[model samples]
Structures are given as C-alpha cells and as structure tokens.
Target: MRILVTNDDGIFAEGIYDLAKALQDIGEVIVAAPNSERSATGHAITIHHPLRVDKVRFFDTTIEAYSISGTPADCVKLAVEALLKDRRPDIVISGINNGPNLGTDVIYSGTVSAAVEAAIMDIDSIAISMGSTNITQYTDAANFVCRIAKEIIHNNDIKDTIININYPTCPKEEVKGVKVTTLGVRKYENTFIERKDPRGNSYYWTSGNVVDMEQNQDSDILALQNGYISITPIHFDLTHFKTFEKIKKLNFQK
Candidate 1:
C-alpha cells in the first residue's frame, strides 16, 4: 500500500509531520507539500510559473519527503505526474490540517482542495482536519485518518467519494463517535484594518471571525462542535440535476 501525503500547511508544519509519522507503519509514505503555508488557497493549480521540488529531511530516516514551490493542488499534480510517474500511489491523503475545513469552508481550503484534486484524477483520497488550532490533538485526528485510509484501501464499496474529516479539539476519550454529515453553511464577519507603513503609506489587512451559522443537526460543523468527528463525502460534479430538469421544462427559443 502506497500513500501520498500532503497538506496546505508547509512541509515543516507539525500537522503534516505528525500525520506522516502515524501512517508510516501502514505502508510506504511519500510526502510532497508546499514549501510555505498555503492555507485557504482553494484548488488553484500552477500553469504559468515553473514548479520546483527539492528533497527535504522530514523525519530522521523514515518517509521520503519533498518541498514544492506551488499550491497544495500542484503538489499532488507534480507528485503523481513527475515524482511517482512510473507508479501511481494507491491512495492520497491530504492533511491533518492545522485547522478545521467544515461546512462551506472546504470551498476555500487548500487542504480539502488537495484531496479534491486527487479525486478528480480518479484516485482514492481523504482530507483530515482538526477543529482546534492547537497541535496537540493531531495525533487523535491522525489515528482516525489512518483508520479511514485503511478502511478505504481494503474496502471496494468506498470508491467514488472524497472523504473530508474533522476532529474536534478535545481528548480522544471525550469524542462521542464519528458522524456522517452534510455540508453546512458558515458566514464570516469580515473586517479590514488599515495601517500606515514606514513611509506613511496606507495599507490594509484583511481579517474576519467565522460566524456560526449552523442550524442543521446533521451538519459537519455541528458534529464537530458536539465532540464528534465529522465525515462528509465530497465529489466534484457541481451539476444541479434537479435545477437542470426544472429549467429544461421551460420552453425557450430553440
């Protein structure tokens, strides 16, 4: 079993390293990640600039790792297309992400986007995230990730879906259990702060607090908030079949 591990967080981030270490016992782990933090970068792939990859020392001597100068999506693209050209990985796992990618947050998350890219290429993929900003809970998240990956690798019925998981910020014992959920909506109280530079030039900094808009009981955000791991299956097909049929019923100028 070969696994390609990646993260929106830089190659040196604690989350990625911990995840890699956890999965090393499972199979051959090869890591390809951004050279710097690329959080919330979405599914952007580089087509203009030339990408650069360099071997980096991650764990003392276990997994083969590389630092990539591109987005999270680019790492997976280059890994399969360039690095592991002869042998495609059996599965791709993106992140024990430093933060949660619940609800609509996945739309802007490079962590989840990396997994989406793998799914686009018809590869089995999963994205793991921890709800807390603290790094201490990553082990618990990694354990769950390992479990899911093992299940997918051994089970054939689990194909055709990208698994998105989020672990709450609590002790492993406090976790209730895993909950299969749907995507919830989350809005943010966006704010911009203006400051003066050394030359008295005005600069603006963008920041926002994520507003809790969760009302659905079976939502990913709600599940995580209630101390349960959230698992949401994501797919790339954006067609609104119901809406398409409704529109098709309308007679227009053909």
Candidate 2:
C-alpha cells in the first residue's frame, strides 16, 4: 500500500515525525506537509499565491518528503495533482496533530481538512489527533493509528469514507478502550486583549477559554475525557435531508 501523510502542525513537528515512522511499517509513506504551522486553517487552498514544494531530508533515513508553502489541504492537493500524479497513494493520513480535534472543532481544523480533501478525491482518509498538547502521548496515538489503519485497509469495506481518531491524554494502559462516536458540541468564551505596539497603535490579541458543553456519554468529547480513543466517521456533505423534505412539502405556486 502507498500512504500519503500530511499535517497542519508543520513538516518538522514531533507528532508528524513519529506518525510517519509508524506508518512506514504498513506501506510506502510519502510526506508533503506545510513548511510552517497552519493550524485551524480549515480546507483552504492556495490559488492566489504560487505553491512551492521542496524535497528535503529531516529524518536519518532516506524518505520521500516535501516542504510545501501551502495549507494542509494544499499539501494533499499538490501531491495528488502534481507530485504523485501517476502513482497516487492508496490512502491519505493527516496529522498526529498537536492537539485534539473534537466536536465542532473539526470544522475549523486544518488537520481534519487535510483528510477531507483526500476524501473529496475519492481516496480513503484518516485524521489522527492527540488530546494533549504534550508530545509524549504521540507514541500511543501512533500505535492506535497503526491498528485502526490496518483494520480499515484490510477490511476493504471501510475505505469509502473519512475517519477521525483522537487519542486521549493518558498512558496506553490507562486508555479503557476505543469507541466509535458522534461529534459533540464544544463552546468557547472568546476574549480580545487590546494592546499598544511600539508606535503606540492599538492591537488586539485573540484568546479563548473552552467552556464545557453538555454532551452525551457516547460523544467523541466524552469518550476522550473518559480515557478512551474516539473514532468518528465524518463527511463533507452538508445536506439537511429532513429540512429538504419539510421544505418540499410547502407548495409555492410559480
């Protein structure tokens, strides 16, 4: 199997590095990631600015890698459309992200968007994230990824959609188990601190604190908090079928 790896955490991030190494045991892994961090940059593509891709070696062994001057989604796009045009990857895995992409957070996550981009291209995709900001939990996350990826690939029937996995911030043994979950609601109270620059001009720094929202026990958020890995199958289709049917019942004469 051929695997394409990308992330929003930058090409040299510890999470991505560990993830690439783990994935290598399963298939030929090629990484094409952003040169710098592009967190929360949802499914953005580079159209105005020219996209640049450079081949470089960051690991001790020789591995095909590219530093891209684009968003996480752009990495996958460029790799499929240009870099590996003839030999496209069988699967695209994004992240091993620095932090969790849970609930509604996935909407704004570049990590998840990278996988979404691959799914749009009809390729099997997975987004891997760790609940903690610390890099120490990455090994456990990578192991979980290996297990899940193998299950999905070998099973065959599971490759048609995108899968999001968020590992809890706990020891491997401490993790109770894995749960297939649904996306939950997550709210945040945002704050803006106004400050003065060297020239005395006003500048505002954006910050926010996550406010715990009411969620079901079966939700991804609760699963992670309970020391369980959460796997949520997601898609780009936003059609509200119920609403469509409701509106269709209203008869409006032309």
Candidate 3:
C-alpha cells in the first residue's frame, strides 16, 4: 500500500515527521506538505501566483517532499495533479495537527482541508489532530492514526465517509476510548486583537478563547472533554438539511 501524507504544519513539523515514520512500516509513505505552516487556511487554492515546489531533506528520512507556496488544499491538489501524476496514492492522510480540530474549528482548519481535498478527488482520506498546544510526543497519535488508516484501507463501509479525529492531550492509557461524534458549537470570546506596529501602524491579530458549551454528550467537544478520542465524519457538502425543507416550502417566482 502507498500512502500520501501531508499536513498544514509544514513538512518539517514534528507531528508530520513522526506520523510518516510510523506509517513507513505499514506502507510506502510520501510526504507532500506546505513549505511553511498554513494552519486555519481552510480550503483555499492558489490562483494568481505560480506555485513552486522544492525538495529538501527532513531529518533522517530521504522521502520525496515538496514545499508549495499555497494553502494545504493547494498542496494536495498540486500533488495529485502535478507532482504524483504518474502514480495515484491509495489514501491521503493529513495532519497530526498541533491542536485539536473539534467543534466548528474544523471549518477553518487547513489540516482538515487537505484531507477534504483528497476526499473530493475520490480518494479515502483522514485528518488527525492532537488536542493540545504543547505537543512534546506524537507517537501515540501516530499509532492511533495508523490503526485507523489500516481499517479504512481494508473496509469498504468505512471508506464512505471522511474522518476527522481529535486526540486528547493525555497519556494513551488515560484515554477512555473512541467516540463517533458530530461537530460541536464553539462560541468565541473575541475574534481579533488590535495591535500597533513599531512604525505606529495598527493591525489586527486573530485570537480567541474557546467558549464552554452545556453538556452535549454526542458532540466532539464533549467527547474530547471526557478524555475520549473524537471521530467525526465530515463531508464537503455545506447544505443545511434542516433549512432545506423550509426553503422549499417558500414560494418563489418561476
């Protein structure tokens, strides 16, 4: 089996590197990721500027890697369309992201976007994230992802959905179990922070704190809060099913 591994955390991130190493024993691993961190970039693609891909050495692994001047989605697009045109990978796995992609956070995550892009291309894909800012060790997350990837590659039923997994920031033994969940709501305290440059020009920075929600046992947030790995099946479709019938009932000009 051949696996295409990518992430929003750049090619040299510890998370990506660890994940690649772990999967190497299972299959041929290929790393195609951003040259720099592109966290929270969503599904944006590069349109105007010409994209450049450079091959560089990352740690001990002499893997063929690329650094593209684009978003995470663009990296996956360019990889399949241009880089790996001759051989299509069996699956695409994005991230062991620096932080968890729970609740509405997935909407803005480039880590998840890369996986979504792969799924749009009709390949099985998954986005893996660790629910912590301080990521000292990634082995546990990598192993967990490897186990899921193996199951996904073999099972036809699991291939029908795109997976977004979030691991809590605790010892593997402390993890209760895995929970299949839905996206949760994340209210924010603030969206932006105003700052002044040394030249006195004012600029805004995006920063916010996660808002607590009332206990909803089925949500990703709640699952993570309770020390369980959250696996939320995500899709590219943005149709609001609840509002669809209501909108259909409204009469409009023919």
TM-score of each: 0.95, 0.95, 0.95
Clashes of each: 0, 0, 0
TM-score (C-alpha) between model 1 and the true structure: 0.95
Error of 1 at 150 (Å): 1.0
lDDT of 2 by residue, 79-129 (tens): 999999999998899999998999999999999999999999989899999
Off by over 4 Å in 1: 196-202, 251-254
- Tens-place lDDT per residue, model 1, 36-84, is 9999999999999999999988867568999999999999999998899
Worst 10 residues of 1 by lDDT: 134-143
Measure candidate 3: CA RMSD: 1.6
Worst 10 residues of 2 by lDDT: 152-161
102 Cα displacement, candidate 3 (Å): 0.5
Q: After best superposition, candidate 1 residue 115: deviation in angstroms?
A: 0.2
Ordered list by lDDT, greatest first: 2, 1, 3
Whole-model lDDT, model 3? 0.89
Single out the weakest 10-residue window by summed lDDT for candidate 3: 153-162
